[model samples]
Target: MNQSDEVEITLQVCDPKIIAGLNKFIVYTIKGMDKNGQFDIQRRFSDFKTIRSFLLTKWPGCYIPPVPPRKAFGNLEQQFIDERRLMLEDFLKKIATLKYLWYSEEFQVFLKTPGEIEKALLSVPKITNEEIINKYQDAFSDLSGREINREIIQKINDFKAYIQKISPMVQNFKQIAKNIAEAKSSFQASLIHFITVFIPEYENNVLLEYVEQKERLIFANLIQNEDAQGLINQYCDLLKEPKFQELYQEVRKEGKQLKAFLETFAEREKYESQKANAESRQKELQLELQEVLAGKTTIRTLFSKGKKEDHITKLQQQIADVGKEIESYQFICDILTVLVGYVEIDKFKMEKQFQYYNMIKNIISYEINLSKIAEEFWSKVLKSENMQQQQ
Candidate 1:
């Protein structure tokens, strides 16, 4: 391996800090390291966008991996910042592995002195839409020969056929990830509602009242129980107060909000991880196809009394295996959807039925407590009377 091959580039995204300017924005310090040295560069998401554009212009037809979405809202959250940081790191790593890209003067300069990025960017004019159209049009005219066109067309068609097999699988995987994430969100919300709202309501309206009734009946026959009765009345009055109800509602709302936010944040992390793997594989296949079309890589020929036929057979088997794996994933996703639906239904029913049972239990428990206290008081009175008669 040459010196260039020995050069290993690594990128680390540091914690985000607020950029000082007229309009303060959050930016992260991307720490880049190679055999040469280490450099710390602070950049916003737009900087990454510019870099992607530069790459596309420099390496046309080469697959560029997807970047973090340029979201206009909620970008300030620490979790959002962290997720984007990871994506940016991945983007840098991919670029570093490309020989022509990593060693470019522009890339080296950007890494060494980020302050001069604007100057570097200005040197490469954005490709005009008209120019792009004209280039393709001229290319087609150059390939006007029927034989040449037929061969190129056949190669393109074969490439498309192979890609078509992988495309659906990639699409299905993304869809499954999306549905699972949404379902997880819904489940989290339902669970929070059950814990914060339903459970609290049951405790306050049912348990408190049941316990209060027992105390009330026990003090009914005691002449000197004014202090105890007053304490019980105070507790009942507090339960009825609007301020107390408002506070309870606020707490419940906050609990749900916090739980939902935390859970959704975690879901985003998991979704991004799954998405990165899919996108990487998709881009790999796309780059391979592009290389084949561009004549950079030799195309496999069939039945030529060599390893070409074996190579093609191996590729065909891999595609078949991927198709089977996709089918299994689809089945699993379907089952998960059904299960999530069932859980939602059960959760709703539980909420409704629990409230009813809660009310019934409160009433039954209060009556039972009162009856026990009354029975004890009467038993004492009867015993005193019987003792007087015997004396």
Candidate 2:
């Protein structure tokens, strides 16, 4: 949160517990530290979803990190749950880098709140869309405080179309990764099934232990591959449901409101007569007040000189009230314009860089792990052959 602050988060412990007859869930042991010191918290998958939902609602214009997709318990529940934990850690670590979000009340509740966070998150003050705009501007005034101009609005419009175009491509890639992961899982299952049948069939079983060791290494490769690719898919989901799109919608919504607001000013049928009458009366009062100050109107104009003065005072109040009303309308226009045209869409551009960087890193690490698995498997195979020849 500050220059001296350090943060670390990892979700390595997931204890699967069953409750109420077949309703099973994963409870993750989230451990982390901050400038305050190290702390540990336990949260469920629902809890992760809860925190993400809170952030999404409260910070419409900012990036709210993605959570793993909700899926029913399957044969690969443990592996999937483990993969989800890793992804959740990535989510938190990404959030920690953004200072505004790191110190956000909702996130702080998630990181340090003593008990269940959902209720506490409710206690976190609700911010309106206008307020959200102000909050982001306060945080990134140098970058995003400018009024939304027609040029930037057009750029955002282009970006909206671009995201729509790219989202399906990302979704298709996620599907492919998912298919590969599932196929590997099935392959691992077949290998386990074969090992059970094959190992006991050997009477001497001289090759038994070596086969088992290779099996374990092969299993590790498949599991780790699934783990890594699972994250890639999660990242794809993030790209599909991006914060830029949400912020764009916020701007568009405000633009629509502004349009309707201007329409109110131009509604000749409904407001034109009233506006004309108010303007005419204001002019009349101004002229009359000027004449009163100049002593051009009679003191007996309103039964007494004091009543005549009171009339002048009332005219002054009416003009002031009209001016205040005009200022209020202008203020609303200013706020709306600032939101609809503010900020470059570079937030997502930067996020794309981050998402791709980390996604590629996971991919490279997964490949390296596969190489190690291969090396270990081959070494075991050759050593087993040597032992058999020596015997």
Candidate 3:
């Protein structure tokens, strides 16, 4: 079926539970509906793995989301089961969104009647480990002999390595996000405290200090915007010091770097998506090529047997083109990996620099405290003077 099929699918992952009908095996009940029909399928985690392997083999072009790792012994944990259910739901949603796979017979069978799959699995003969190894040894030897499979294997390893490297960095990024959030909260709170609490109390001394420095400087109403502006200017001058200036420049530099990193990251994601599309198209082309060669479609009669070769040739060309596109995306992704690594390093350094330079905020804090003390001192002095005058 094509993209025009009026198809829609929705799935909900239920909490894991054991049931009597299912032989007490802990399984997830997935409730879903589509234009074709609705279904409630009880599936064990192992069932998902089996079907996923089939999908990867038969529909390599589809973007299959990763599933949660299997737990042999700890599968009974409620929290782990919940997380796995969420991930499984996500995977199903991705499969549903792939229009090409929506009408796939295997996928439909999987969603509509899972009991059929169970029966098929039951019919399959089990082999001993020795027999399995002996039977697959030749296949493994043949696979190792093929350059293409070797390259694919290498790419898979590289992908896994990249994920391993980035996993900790991604976790660390959560802390960075939290740190920035707290910093912002602190900044906002400081503004509120300065305006609401510190201003009326400390403004007299902090603002009047300049009056002592500049002789004959007339102070406007003590609590006016004029005093606040003077204090702001004084604070600005302190920040203009060379040490603070350098720190400010560093922050700006880091900000620009972050902008660049974000732009490159967006490009990387775009190309990655494009690669997925191209790979899907490649699979289509390959399938078409197979059909033409096998004379399984109208191309054999319409194009004539002799000209049928031309269709196969054209399909092969399209497949090659998509393959090249996939390669280009892979190269771009590799470069992006390096760039992201650098960005992560830069981010760590930037966080440290920000924490160090944030000490500059203490200047205003110190001014506020000193002004509070001075205001208290003057209040005492005026009270004593008034008492003496009354006497």
- The numbered model that scores best in TM-score is 2
Question: For every model shown, what is its TM-score relative to the native structure?
Answer: 0.41, 0.53, 0.34
- Where does candidate 3 clash, by residue pair? none
lDDT assessment of candidate 2: 0.54
Q: For candidate 2, lDDT tens digit of each residue in 49-142?
A: 8887777566543445565566765724665566566666766776777657777788878877867777878788877434654675577666
Residue pairs with backbone overlap in model 1: none
The model with the greater TM-score, 1 or 2, is: 2
Quality of model 3 by C-alpha lDDT: 0.54
Q: Which stretches of candidate 3 lie over 4 Å from their true place?
A: 1-4, 19-24, 116-391
TM-score of 2: 0.53
Give me the displacement of residue 164 in model 1, in angstroms: 9.1
Choose 1 or 3, whichever is better by TM-score.
1
Give model 3's TM-score versus the native structure.
Answer: 0.34
The 10-residue segment with the lowest total lDDT in model 1: 241-250
> Model 3, 120: alpha-carbon shift in Å?
4.0
Worst 10 residues of 2 by lDDT: 261-270
